[model samples]
Target: MSDEPLVRTVRPGVRVGVDVGSARVGVAASDPTATFAHPVRTLARDEQHGTDLTELVTLVEELAAVEVVVGLPLLLSGQEGEAARIARDYAVALAARVGTVTVRLVDERLTTVDAHRRLRDSGVPGRGQRKVVDQAAAVLILQTALDTEARSGKPPGEPVTTGGRRKKERRR
Candidate 1:
């Protein structure tokens, strides 16, 4: 483990953001210039993980994504929790499948809450929210990442190394 933070250049290109869940995965994509993130779709997870991964690859190819950003659900204290571990595992699995495209994990603290709020503000009821909340959360996560990179001039979040260990775990 190293003390230095791994930082990457924030480049302009199509980027995809993923919010992984046990039941569903939400996907969002940015434009070529990487200005905005829009909700793409939510895919139901099949019993075979390979099938879901293949769909992700196909989506990446169709969108011409240069980067794949996955939401890392860190605790409020900025510590890795159980959900974080699950997210990291999913990200590692995703990274292995996406050849060449950069895979990143960004902290997603209140994205889901914000998504719920947004849906409520838009007058979407609870039942309606269930169908699209994940997608909305994905949008929030990707948009935050894009804005962070734009403001800081550094890539948002930590890059997911190909070694199957997440940034925090690598420190251990």
Candidate 2:
């Protein structure tokens, strides 16, 4: 198989957004036209790696998602810090988990903050937000990516390559 990351065409179709966290993963999906993203559900992270990935793969299959967008949490100054590294690792694992499906890592600096604010404004108590915060963040991540692609005529962010290579490396 080619080691290069898959570059999916920027078109209208169902897309899934993922916000990976230590304990929970938030999932969101876009409409067939890719106009809006809505929260799907929050999934618990299994302690075993295989089980976690399996759940994600099952979700992908069930959604028939054309592309999977994984949020990359970069620093405010655009640097890839430790959190970014973890996100990248998750993206690579996720890409490998769901073979043939495109996984893109979009910059998601303030999506979590936005999610929290939205939940607060909507009267979701801080105590109860944990159950759905990840889903809310996933929605923001996907919506931002969809909007970016629509405005630029290009897919937002970089695709996550399978195997162990980084996205910046070119296959020789």
Candidate 3:
């Protein structure tokens, strides 16, 4: 594992973002400079439990990611639901499997909606878009994390912003 900081510093290597779902897993990756996030690939969920996670870990390793960000789907009321719990559990397991890489969760409210809108705006056919929705959502999640880090002066892996817009930093 690289000695790079996980949360704030834009280290010189790839950082991975994941949108985990029951049916599919969307993956995105950012450049080391943290300037852009590009959709990588989506993996179909394995019928056998735990198999998909093992695959996910391999994918992360292949990307040579310094940090892993998993999307946590919180309800609009900001409460954890079954999906959130599952995502968190997956994150814990993924962290253990990856070893040495920082695995973090970022609130992923509205990411799917945003991704759908983006695809529609881009003229992607609805039927074709379904295949890649998870990948697009993963990109959105990663982009949001990067934007939050930039605005809040927090490191990339740190949880700085809440569900809403970033709060104004108080003047010293």
List RMSD in Å for every model shown: 7.1, 7.9, 9.2
**lDDT (Cα, tens digit) per residue for candidate 3, span 29-51:** 99877657899889887747778
lDDT string for model 2 (19-138, tens) is 988888899999988889999988888747557667888988998877889999999999999889988888888887776678899999989999999999999999999999999999
Clashes of each: 0, 0, 5
In terms of lDDT, the best-performing candidate is 2
**lDDT scores in order:** 0.84, 0.86, 0.78
In the range 1-172, model 1's lDDT, one tens digit per residue, is: 9898855335778889998878888889998877899999988866464677789889998987888899999999999989899888888888887777778999999898999999999999999998899899999999999988876887788888767544332110
Q: After superposition, how far is residue 89 of candidate 2 from its true place, in Å?
A: 0.7
Better of 1 and 2 by lDDT: 2
TM-score of each: 0.87, 0.87, 0.81
lDDT of 2 at 124: 100
Model 1 residue 73 distance off true place after TM-score fit, in angstroms: 0.4
With a 3 Å backbone cut-off (N, CA, C), the pairs that clash in candidate 3 are 7-155, 7-156, 7-157, 8-155, 8-156
Clashing pairs in 1: none
State the lDDT at 36 in candidate 2.
Answer: 93
